[model samples]
Structures are given as structure tokens and as C-alpha cells.
Target: MNNQLPPPPAQMMQLITGFWTSCCVYSAAKLNIADHLKDKPQTAHQLAEATHSDAPSLYRVLRALSSVGVFKENEDHQFELTSLGNTLQTDAPGSMKAMAIAQLGDHYNAWGNLVYSIKTGHIAFDNIEGMSVWKYYEMHPEEGVNFIKAMSGLTGAVIQHVLPEYDFTSFNTIVDVGGGNGALLVAVLDKAPQAKGIVFDEEYVVAETKKLIAKKGFSSRCETAAGSFFEFIPENADAYLMKMVLHDWNDEQCLQILNNCNKAMKAGSKLLVLDSVIPEGNEPHPGKFMDINMLAMTGGRERTEKEFASLFSNAGLKLARVIPTHSPMFSIVEAIKE
Candidate 1:
């Protein structure tokens, strides 16, 4: 087993051409190819007819994705879903279909202007789209719903790893601040049956969240609140959970949110912030790249432990500990209200 790095030019070429794979996967996802292939193997011609696409062009995409292990090509040119491909199924657990569309659709233009953001220190999405991502979603409700589904998909992927690492059973009440669609809170409440929850977010978002809560048959134990985290949060929950929330803001905005959480928190309560805590030094990490995505789209960032500690202190909370999960992409940054 060799531990040496690949030659620089070869590695750089792979890095530069990474988008080829992304675009191919996006095409597959957009066309619902994975869902079509889920029950049985199908030739690209069959898939093309089902998707209303050109057979030859669709075959090329399936062939490309097959090389990357997203699908498998057989002797007769039939394509079948690999385990990786199954994740792109719309109804699959932790589905990435919506995420694929979003990243390649709405987020594509903003990411293309990343150089502009780098040069001017402005949000590329706002510069390119002429509105904040949130407002853009509001004006485009279909896209907004897809975006929410994308977030829920992402949360679904990570929650399995998170629940085992942290205990939610102790809290009698949990508030998921900026909880989109109540997925995380619902999962937590399932584990902590003694705990009731509130899914707190903007008015538009919580409307859908309420329906989800009722659908999950948790309507009595969990409720939805419509409001912004900047102005107010529901007061005095035993625990507040913010998963992938603070990473969408800059330091000043983060402080405002933290402060609001502080004001709403009762003494001896805990705030569990689930986000990527970028470690120090040059070891490769997903958060390092996600940090760039933040810069390009939201003017936000992934924080280091030191950064989180400082942010917590500024909001008058004590950084209790940073708990690692099975996945390195996230950590539980636990803080306490004294």
C-alpha cells in the first residue's frame, strides 16, 4: 500500500474536471433516471422514452455516470442503479435528487461568479441574482419548496450519525431554531419521547413544517412557530437545537442569532449547534470546501472551534464542549447559559 500523493498535474486535472461528474449526476437526477432504474435495469433508450429525452444523449450520460459508480452498465447496455445512484431517488431516505437540481440549477450561476465574490467580498448569489437567496426563494415558491426539501434531505443524511453521538433524552423541551420542515426536531422527539418540540422559522417555512408535523403524527407533542431568529425566539426551552443554521450567516449576524438564543434560553439550559467545525491545519476536510460554498452563496462560513468559542463568548454563553460525531463533516458545539 503506497501512501505517496499523486503527481501534481494529474491531481490538478482531476480537480479541475470535477464538475464533469457533478453535471452528469445532475442530469441523471433531473431526469429521474435513478427512480426509473430502481425497480429494474433499463437500456438508455427505455430510460430516454420514459424521461422524454434523446436515447443517444441519455446513454452517454448513463455511461459517464457508470464509470463513476453511480450506475452499472451491463453487457447489453442496460443501466442499473448502484447504491450511490439509489440516493438520487426522490423518495429514498436521505435523497439527493432535489439537492442535485438545486446545486446545478439555482446555485450554478452564483457559483460561476465565485471569482466576482472573491474580488469584491460580496455574496455572489446576490450579485448575480439581484436578490438574497432567501428572497429569491420567496419570489420563486417552487424553487423555495425544492430548496427546503434539499435541506431536509441533507439533515436526514446526517441525523443518523448525530443521534448516536449526542443524547436528546434529558431535555423536556427542545426548540429547533430555524428548523426547516421539522425533520430534525421530529427525529429528536422520537428518541426523547418525554420532550416536546417547537420548529421555529420564518412564516413561509413553518407553514409546510406544520403539515409535516401533523403528517408525522407528532402534532400534539410538537408545534410550529413562525418568526425570524434575529428578532425573537420562543422563550425558555430546556434545549435549543440549530443544525446547519448559523453557518448561513457571517460573524455579526451569527452573534445576533446567538444573542437572541441567549435571551430566550433559561438558566442552566443548553444550546446544541450542529455544524461543521473546521479543524485547524491543512488536512483535507469537507467543511473546507463547504466554506467556499458559503462564501459564494450566503456570505456565511464554516467555523473553527476557536471561532465558535469566540462567537459563543460574544453572545454571553459558555462553550461547554465540542462533541465529534461519527462523520467529520459535523460536530455538536454545545454551549451553556449560566
Candidate 2:
């Protein structure tokens, strides 16, 4: 007989009610609680007054978080930042503060409407926000800026992993398609000093990129262009690099962008797609969860290697290889013009 016991009911309940813990972390990050406690531990009332929250309620939240090692509860309801909590600081290395803000503030609503997305096969963000997530951000530039910061925080470490693993020396000009803030392109140019770079994005976004490139003293080697990927991309590029762009779109929409890139590519040019590749089976993978998030938020899906190859073939490109990075969740999917 198979002798095994299920987890305790309380443990199962904890798994089911896990969003509460996430919200606690989000609230702490949003209120800048970690930064406040950086200097020294402070009473919950002190933090409450600084953050304009209720003392007792804040104490409850912090106490709950302490159980998860985010913060530590001390004498007199004082709370101190743990190592995990330090990552929520805005200026900390690999900070996730902005991501917490965006996810808890705007994304929370979309996730709440996930059941509707499941039923309708459409994005819950559009239904709840009454506009596409992109349009909503366009209308609210401050939130849009935060959204970009959030993405940068998420992508920054991944860029470090990508820079060393990929070979950019072979390419003369690399167009960073949908490159935000020009960080990736700037990093690429920094490594491959001989190669010139272009940050291709929306008009408003490229305007920001111009400022960043100039600020980074890369104005000479890196430039900016404004356009939509669905319509056209800069032509005759040795490589077109897109990180996390394809996952924001569905298959048909991705084909539109790829077709545009294919039209813009020369015979020997390459297309580099950087995103998560969902592995087959019931294995635990971040891409599997991210695929559902894409479904709820953008009407997109993370794809497997076969799915990626099929997509590339449909766009008249040949899948070259999928290179793994130190970051297990991300990979480089390279293709060549055919």
C-alpha cells in the first residue's frame, strides 16, 4: 500500500491563502516601510504615523510579514527590516519595490478579474481598466514611468546574465526593438564598443531613450528611432534584439511584428528573441505561472521551443538555437532570415 499523508489542513489553507502574504509585502514596499526601518527598528506606531496608516493595522501586517522573514517584530511592536525586506528598498541592488507597486496597484485589479479572462479568452486588464494596459499607461505618464521602472528592475539582472552569455561582436549594428530606457542597448554597446546601436520604440519612449543615451555618454555610438514594431522596424540591421516583447503579444500579433522585422532584415541578418521558454511536462517552472499572468494581463502566452520554432517559420525565419542563460527562467531564442 502507498503510505503517505497529505499536508495538514492549516498548511493547505496557507497555500490557498497565499495572496495575503503577497499583499502584505506589497503594502510594506508601497509604503516604503523597508527604507524607513533601514536606519533602525521603529515602533509600529511610528511607522504608521510616517506612512499615514493605522498603528494597530500596520502592526498586524508587519507581524504577519515577520513570520515570513520579511521583517522582524521586536519589543513594543517595533519592526526591523530583514535581508529579504531590504530588497524592497528603491535604491537597493536588484530592487523589486517598483514591481511591487505596479503589481499591487494596477495589476491587482486585472488579476482580480482573471475569472472573466478565463471565461472570455481575453485580457482582464482591458475589461477592468476600460482600456488596454498600454493605453492606460499612455494616459497616465507617471504610472507609465513607474511601469517602466518596474520592468527595468525585473530585467536589470537578466541583462547582466545576457550580456556575458551572448555574442554581439559579430554584429555591426544592433537594433533594440521596443528597448525601454535604452538600458539594454547601452549595455550592449558598452561591451561591443565597435558596434553602433539604435533604440527603436514608440515616439514618446524614444524621446526618453535619447535623453538616457546622452546621459550615459553613448550618444555617439547609440541613437534612437520612433516607430511601431507592428508597422515597420529600422531596415538593414545585422541583428534585431527584442527582450520580453513577444510575450506581451499573442501569436497573430507576434507574427505581425516578426513579419515587419523580417521585411526590414537583410538576407544574412539575425533576429534575437529574449524571453521565457515554457518547458514541456508538469515540472515547476516560472514560465508556466508567467504564461497565466500574460493571459490575464495582455492576452499573450509564454510558448515552448516547438511553439517558438513554428512561430519563426510562419514569419519566414529559421530557428537557429535557444541558448540558456545563468538565469534559468530566461533564454535567448535566435533565428535567421530565410
Candidate 3:
């Protein structure tokens, strides 16, 4: 007989009820609770007043999050910021506060309809929100702006890891296809001071991207181009970068974008696709979960190395290699135009 019994049932329950924890963190972030506690410990009542939340209810949520190491609830019912909680602070460098709001607040409704996606193989975001995510952002400009900030926050940390691992020394001009707010493109140009860049996106996004590029003093080295990736990209760049862009699209849509890039590239030019590659086994990887998130929200799916190779081949490009970086969430899926 096998020596071990089945594991405790509570673990299963915790997994099933994981959304409860997600919502608590989302609520805390939305209330700006960490910002309030940045200076010192504060009782729940004080926090409630600052955030305009119910004192008892706020206390319960904070107490729960405290158990998970997000905050420390003292003997006196005061809460102090923990290292993990500090990352939620609005002013913290690489802060995830906006991302928390976007994912758990703005994207939460779509995620709730995950079963719809499984049944119909359609985008849950469209079903629940009455339009695609891009259209929804167009209608709600403020939310769109917040979403951009959230993306910047998430990518800011990722770019630091990417810059050191990838070499841009040889490329003179690079283009960031679907680059939002020009954060990643600016970072790239800053690193390769001799290299120039272009931030290509929809008209509205490029309007804002211009401001960001100028703000970073990359106006001299970086410029903005407004267009759809499915139609055209700037031509003849030494390198084309699509970071976190491919995973937001289905294969057909991704191929359309890639075909455009292929047409825009010179024979020896490169395409640097930065995204998480789903590992082959059952080994724990965040991309496996994030793939489902893409399916739910964007009608996109993350891929394995084999899938990426197929994508490149279909788009008339050749997969060169997959370069690992310090960041586990993404890798450089390098390809060359044939």
C-alpha cells in the first residue's frame, strides 16, 4: 500500500477560494491603504476615515491581509506597512498600485466570466464589458490613462532586466510596435544612447507617447508613429521589438502583425519578441496562469517555444533563439527575417 494519505482538504479549498484573497488585496490597493500607513502604524478607524471605508469592515480585511504578510496588525489594532505592502504604495518605485486596480478592478468582471470563454472560445472581456478592451478604453479615457500607467508600472521593472540581457549595440534604429506610453522604447534608447527608436501605436496612444518620449529627453533619439500593427509598421528598421504584444492576440491576429513586421524588415533585420514562454511540464510558472488571463481578457494566449517557432515560420520569419533573463516573467524570443 502507498504510505501517504491524501493531503489535507483545506488546501483545495484555499485554491478554490483564491479570488477572495485577490479581491481583498485589490480593495486595499484601491483604498490607498498602504500610502496612509507609510509613515507609521495606524488603527483601522484612522485608515477607514482616510479612505472613507467602514471602520469594522476595513479592520476585517486588513486583519485578513495581515495574516498573509501584506500588513502587520498590532496588539492595539494598529496596522503597519510590511515590505510586501510597501510595493502597493502609490509613490513607491515600480509600484503595482495601478496594476492592482486595472487587473482586479477593471479586468475583474471579465475574469468572472471565465466559464464563458471555456464554453465558446470567445473573449470574456467582450461579453461582460460589451466591447473589446481597446474599444472600452477608447470610450473611457480616464480608465485608459490609468491602464497605461498600470502597464508602465508592470513593464518598468521588466525592462531593467531586459536591457542587460539583450544587446542593442549593433542596431541603429529600433521600433517598438504597439509600444504604450513609450516607456519600454524610451528605456531601450536610454541604454543604447547611439541608437534611435520609434514608438508605433494608435493615434491616441501616440499622442501621449510623444509627450512621454519628450519628457524623457528621448525626443532627439525617439519619435512616434501612429498606425495599426495589422496594417503597417515603420519600414527598414534594424530591429523591431514587440514586448508583451504578441500574447495579447490570437494566432491569426498575431500573424497579421508579424507579417506586417516581416514586410517592413530588411533581409538581415531582427524581431525581438519579449514575452513569457510557457514551460513544457507541470513545473510552476506564472506564465501558465497569465496565459489564462490573456485568454479571458484579450482573446490572446501565451505560447511555448514550439508555438513561437510555428508563429515565426508562418509569418515568414525564422526563430533564432530564446534568450533567458533575470526576470522569470519574460524572455527574448529573437527571430530574423528570411
Candidate 4:
């Protein structure tokens, strides 16, 4: 084995130019190039006509992506979708298409101003867009819907790893606080057969969540509620699940949400928080990067176990355990109402 790292300059250069790859992937996703290439290989000219893009320009982009193994270029100049590229397809299981578009489109400007966020200790997105992301979503419904889809896709990708690592069967009622689209709740209900669930979120989000519950044929076992976690949560659930919710707020806001959950929880109830629990030291963890993303986008952060314990204690709960999933990006932070 080589057992050696890349030279510092080479590594630094790659890190500096990482956005070039991101942009290339974003372009392919934006143009639906993966979907077009899904069936079979096609020449750039053919793909260009289908996507209404310039043949030469599209070919150049495809060629660039091919170098990184997203797609493969044949001897005759036809591009074929690789396994990695399949993830960008619109309907692929755990698709990244929406994520690609949103991060590069709506989130691009905010990320560009990351320095401003660091300097001011504020959300760059709010400053850049002149409104909070939640408000911006309200004004631009299309982008809002896409943002929701992006989240759903991300949740879908991690659900398998999360479900198998923990037991949900003991609870009679599972409340997915801030659960969007009912995907996680529906999946949990499916695993727990006897348990009913509620997909709780804001009114507009819950309206869409209802449709997903009904579409999944879980309408009988799962329901949707409209409200904010800051004000209230559905009361007396056996278990409450908050997947990727708390990380969107600062400590003060998280305390408010957690306090509400505590108020609604019974003495014995369990709260399962599904988000990254960042490790200490110079680890190459995704949560560290995501922590920065949270800072720029929502004024939130990924917390360490100590930080979570503090939040739990202040919110009238005790940290029970932190269970690891197969995926490194998430963990089940189980807490209990005392």
C-alpha cells in the first residue's frame, strides 16, 4: 500500500478548487443530464437536442463530469451514465437532483457570503436574501417546494440506516416533530405496525404532508398536524422524533423548541433526535462542514454530545444514550423526560 497522503500543495489546490466540481455536478443536475442518460448512452449532440442545450457546451460539461466518474465518455463521444450519476436522476431512490439544484441555486449566494456570517454571527442567507429562509420560501412557493423535496430526498437516503439501528416498536404513538412530508413517520409506522404517528409541522408544510401520508396509504395510521414547534407540539406521544430539526436553530431557539417538546412529553416518554453529533478533535466529519452550512444558512449548528446534554438538561430531559447508525452523517440521540 502507498500509505501516504497527497502532497500539501496538491491537496490544498484540490480543496481550493472543490467548488469547480460542485458547479459541474450542479450543471449536470440542472439540465437533467442524468435523467436523459438513464436509458442509454447518447452523443452530446443528441443529449443537447433533448435538453435544449448547446451541443458543444453540453459536451464539455459532460466530459468534465466524466473525468470525475459521474458519467463515462465512449470512444465515439457518447456519454453513458455511471452508477454514481444514477443518483442525480429525478426519481432515483435517494435522488440528489433537487439537493444539487437548491444548494447551487438558492443557497449559492448565501454560501458565497460565509465570511459575513462569521464576522457578524448572523445568518448569511437572511442578510443576502433580505428575509429568513422560511419567509423567503413563503414568498417563492416553487423554491420552497423544491427545498422540501430536497430535505425529503436527504431523509429518504438516511432512513434505512436510521431505522435498523433503533427500535420504534415499543411506542404506541410516535410524533415526528418538524417532520416534513411524513416520510420518516410513515417508514417508522411501517416498521412498528402497532404504532400510530403524527407528522407535525407548520400549516403550509402540513398541508403537503397530508397528501404524502394519504398517498402512502398511511392515512389510517398516520395523521398531519399544523403548528410551530416553538408554540406547541402534539401532547402525550409515547415517543417524539426530531430529524434534522434542532440543528436549524441557535441554542436559544433550540431551548425553546426543546422546552415545548418537554412540556408535551410525559414523564416516561422518549425523544429521538436524529442529527449529527459532531465528534471532537480534527476529525474529517461531515457534520463539521454541515455545521458551517447551518451557520451561514440558518444560524444553527451541529452540536457535540456535551452540548446536547446541556440542551436536554435545560429542557427538563436527561440524555439517555447516543446510538450510532451505519451512516456516519447521523446518530440517534435518545433523551427522556424525567
Candidate 5:
């Protein structure tokens, strides 16, 4: 005696249209359409003319995005920014413009060959560039800069969440082991006046952090060191922090990095890993998708609480606590050297 049947399944069409949506988003980013409409609405014709794209085709793309809430289809073929669409505006404080462009840019091609990674367990970047992503980036500085910019922009939101949760007051010295441009290093130093800081990474990355250190007028207290975390790290710091670093590698690589941190630390020194912990079971979390992205890209993973603790224990350390923040998207897992 059922009165109605369930709605038709939207899964297949949604999955099939994912690329179309990505291309739509990419087109908007490339044309600066989001930036153009940040302050006001624009008609399809106006946007097409401004971006020099085909009016009809561009309108179709915009319409499709409007259907998905990236933009609004106001009356008279005009488009206005939706809340979700504002993330693509570069001038916005917490902009994801760079992330969108990068995801939909060179990486998109690599992702197209996801089956290659799935079948072979080798990186698609290696297939594309005849080398790993790091090597390719090292050989191409322009691309490397874009890669860094994309990472920095993506991490900005997460770091803003992390800034308040942890108490940085107690430690006099904090070392960002894999700190990229010293953004978090600068943030920590500014908040904790008593803390001296060291921003450590490869030469190319840490070199630029010096300018930031200079800008912060902590030139004397804050310094940059060039090194690799795998081989060894600058030792004897009161505390060490790595943000969004470990998930870029497999468990063995993660253990190597953590062991390096442990070797460099005295008893009671802290190691902070800022990353997403893949919660157990099918409970639904963004990290599950990210875990797959890691698998496809670097053969890495977004780990769970137990996985994190095991990694810490493997490195001759113990899990101190899993500190949650306002942003459930990331957490700080603290481990102390044995």
C-alpha cells in the first residue's frame, strides 16, 4: 500500500558531471569571473565579452554552475556570486582561488590517469614528467612557486584554526621542521613573544622565510635553517611542529620523519603533527576522500587515531593527546620523545 516510490538515483549523473563542474570552476577561476563579480552581478554577455570567451558556451557553463550553487541565475541571464562561489575570489582573505586553479590545472591531467596509479601504484606525475612530483617541481621553479602558493592558500584556513587551540606560551623555542614559507612560524612567534623560532625546510623554501622573519622584526630571534627531514633535522629544540607534512608520505616515510624528530629531541620535548585523522569506520569524513587522494598521488594516507599512535610508538615516542580545534577538518596530534 505504498503511496510513492523513491526519487530516481542521482549518483551516476553526479559522478559523470564532476569533471564538467571542475572544468566550469576552472574556467571561472582562469577568467577571473569570480573576482569580476565579487562586488556586483554581471550578465552572461558581459562576462563572456570581458573574458573573451564564446558567449553561448560560457553561459551554458555558468548555468550549469548555478544549478550546483557555485553561482546564481538571477532573472535576465545575470549571474551573481553565491557563498560557495566567493571562495574563488583571490583578494578574499581566506581565498581558495589558488587551490581551485591547481586542482583543475596540471594535476587534473594526472588525475585523468588515476587508473594508472590504481593499477600500477606509481605516481601519475612520474608518468607525466618522467620523474616524481618533487623532482619535476625542483626542475621547474615557476611550477614550484605555483605549487607552494596553492599549498599555502589551502593551509591558511587550517592554520587560522590551529593558532588559538594550542598554548605556545610555555615553550621558549619552537621549530617548524617542515615549515614551508614560515607563515605558521611567524604566527606562532607573533603570538608568543617569549618564544624564539626556527623555520626549517629545504634551502629554496627557508630562504624566503627570512624575509618574513625580517618583516616581523624578529630577525635576531627567528631564524631559518635548510635541511631535509628524512636525513636529519636541526636538533635540540624545545618543541617541533610539522603541519600538513606527514600525510604526504606512506607509513614508513612517516616513521622516518618522526624518528628524525625524536632523535633531535630531548625527553619531554614535543612534536606536533597537524593533519586530518581518518576516523575509523564509514562514519563520513573529508579525510576519507583525502586518504584516497593521497593514495592516488603519493602512496600516502590520512591516518586514524590508532594509526597515529602506532606511528608515534614506532618512532620511540608516545601519543600525548589528540587535540581538536574549531576546525574539525584538522587536528594536532602531540607526541613526546621517549
Candidate 6:
């Protein structure tokens, strides 16, 4: 192809320097960077002073983010909000600040031990933190809330995408397993007036879901159930829905969850596993990296369509179809309780 290629390994350089981007995000999140810049932009020194950090170092970080178009640098060295950076600000319309902070917190450490996860198929978090991710979240309330908020923040628009894609009108009672804060269930029930739903999750977390149900005026039709996914799921449901649930667990445990759903369902019951169906080829999808994140944090792996079919078969169900979304990151993998 080209001849003038004896230079820096740009690809490798990018890979190695990827952590720098993380550092910048963390730096911004830590400085209450987005919060400070919400109403107006400020000088780097002013931002650093307000955040109680070293001025010059903060300036450097801001400049790095500016280079990536997260923020715009003026000739006067004032950093102004760019469109991309505004998404990082905390607010309803566009918010990912919480997510950035959480990922940069405990997740960063777990990701650091990716080799351990890849080699042994064990959660790197357990080895590094001496605690399971669940246990850690239970013990750390603030971080747990932040994580949930982050998830809700990221999945905001996803609610709109789901309503039009799936046929919820055909079903009556839908139970959302591990439904955190009842966001998805709320969305579905709000859209489908004929359908009733239950949000199932742990007692501690389901408390929040109850509040959400009440707030959303879904109290009459939507209920919250406290339960564990591994032990058992409630019986008597027309449809079982699990969104972003399975990928947190390994195949064995995934089967356990599916079987639990199977035991609860009658024939002809629909089972919707809302997750990303890993596509074939190295076509540069973000989900591939998400699969790696699962590997690093939990002993779970994302499944391809064929893998889902096999998995469903193991749980005494048949994979009916995979409904692709406008979102490449997620799909509705439909199965049936047979």
C-alpha cells in the first residue's frame, strides 16, 4: 500500500494510551467539572480552585479533553462546553456524569485485572477487592445508588426504543426479573394500558422500585416483589422479561435463572431476554468490549444467537427469534416456555 510507514505505532499507541482518556473523564468527574460548567464555562485555574485541586494539573486535563472535542479551548485559555462534553453534565435531558464516575471508580480496578478473568474465567473484582460485586454494592450504598442512577441515565432513550419494537399487547401479566427501580416495567406498563406488570428484585433494591412505581402512578397495575434471581422466581405469569440480567452471570447461573423462569411459566408463555446478541466477526461493535467488561467484572460472557438458542434449549425453552433494535448494543431475544 503505502511506503512512508516507518513511524510510531499509532494503533498500539492508541491502545496503550486509552487509560489517559479514562483519567481525563475521572478528572472531570472528580472536579465536579460538569457541574461547574453547567451554567457557564470557566478558566482552568478557576475550575481547579473551585474543585480544590492543583490548578496546572487540572488545566492539563481540561486541555486533553478539549483536544478530543469534549470541551473547547479559547485563545484566552477558557474552557467552554462543547456538544459532546455537555452530555457528561448532570441533568435529565443529557446526563452521563454518574456513569463516568462509577466506571472510573470500582470498575476501573476490576478491568485492570482482565488477564485474570480471561485466563481463569473468574471475576477479577473478587480477587482484587476481596468481595463479590454484589456484596460490595450492598455494603456501599452511595456507590450502588450511583451505579443504578448511571444505568438509568444511560438507558433513558432505550425506553422509547423498546415500546415500538416488541409486541407487549399480546401478553397480560409480565414479570420483570431483576428489574432495577422498575424503569423498564414502568415504561412498558405506561405504554400498554391493557398489561399489568410486577418488578422483581432484591428486597433492598426493590424498595427503590416501589418508590418509582408510586411516583410514576403505576402502583395499581405495577407491583414490586422482593426475591433473588438464583433461588427462585415467582409463579403465574404470562410473560417473563429480563433486561441486561443474564450477562452478569456465567452460563451455569444463566441456566439457573432461565430454569427458574421456566418453572414459573405455563405453556405458550413468552420469555424475553433483553440483552445484546453478540454478532460474528470483528466488525468493531462496542458490545465486544462490553463482553470483555463482563469477563473482567463477572464470570459471564455475552452470547451469540446460536449460543442463546443452545442456552434456551438447556432451560427447556425454544428460541423463537431475536428482534434487533435501532440500538446495536441491545436486542430482544425471544424464547418460549414449552
TM-score of each predicted structure versus truth = 0.97, 0.93, 0.94, 0.97, 0.91, 0.92
List the RMSD of every prediction in angstroms. Answer: 1.4, 2.7, 2.6, 1.3, 2.7, 2.5
Ranked by lDDT from best down, the candidates are 1, 4, 3, 2, 6, 5
Q: Indicate the TM-score of model 3.
A: 0.94
lDDT of 3 by residue, 96-123 (tens): 8888888897798988899999999999
- Clashing pairs for predicted structure model 4, backbone only: none
Q: What's the lDDT for all of these models?
A: 0.93, 0.90, 0.91, 0.92, 0.84, 0.85
Better of 1 and 2 by lDDT: 1
Give the C-alpha lDDT of model 2. 0.90
Regions more than 4 Å wrong, model 4: 1-6
List runs of model 5 lying over 4 Å from the truth.
1-8
State, as a TM-score between 0 and 1, how close model 5 is to the true structure.
Answer: 0.91
lDDT of 4: 0.92
List runs of model 6 lying over 4 Å from the truth.
1-8
Residues 1-338, model 4: lDDT tens digits: 99898999999999999999999999999889999988889999999999899999988989989999999999988999999999899988788889998999899999999999989998999999999998998999888888888988888777767788988889999999999889989999999999999999988788878888899999999998899999999999999999999999999999999999999999899999999999999979999999999999999999999999999999989999999888888999999997
Q: Candidate 2: where is the Cα deviation over 4 Å?
A: 1-8, 74-78
Name the lDDT value of residue 49 in candidate 4. 98
Residue 200 in candidate 6, Cα distance off native in Å: 0.3
Instruction: Compose the digit string of candidate 1's lDDT tens values, residues 219-309.
Output: 9999999999999999989999999999999999999999999999999999999999998999999999889999999999999999999
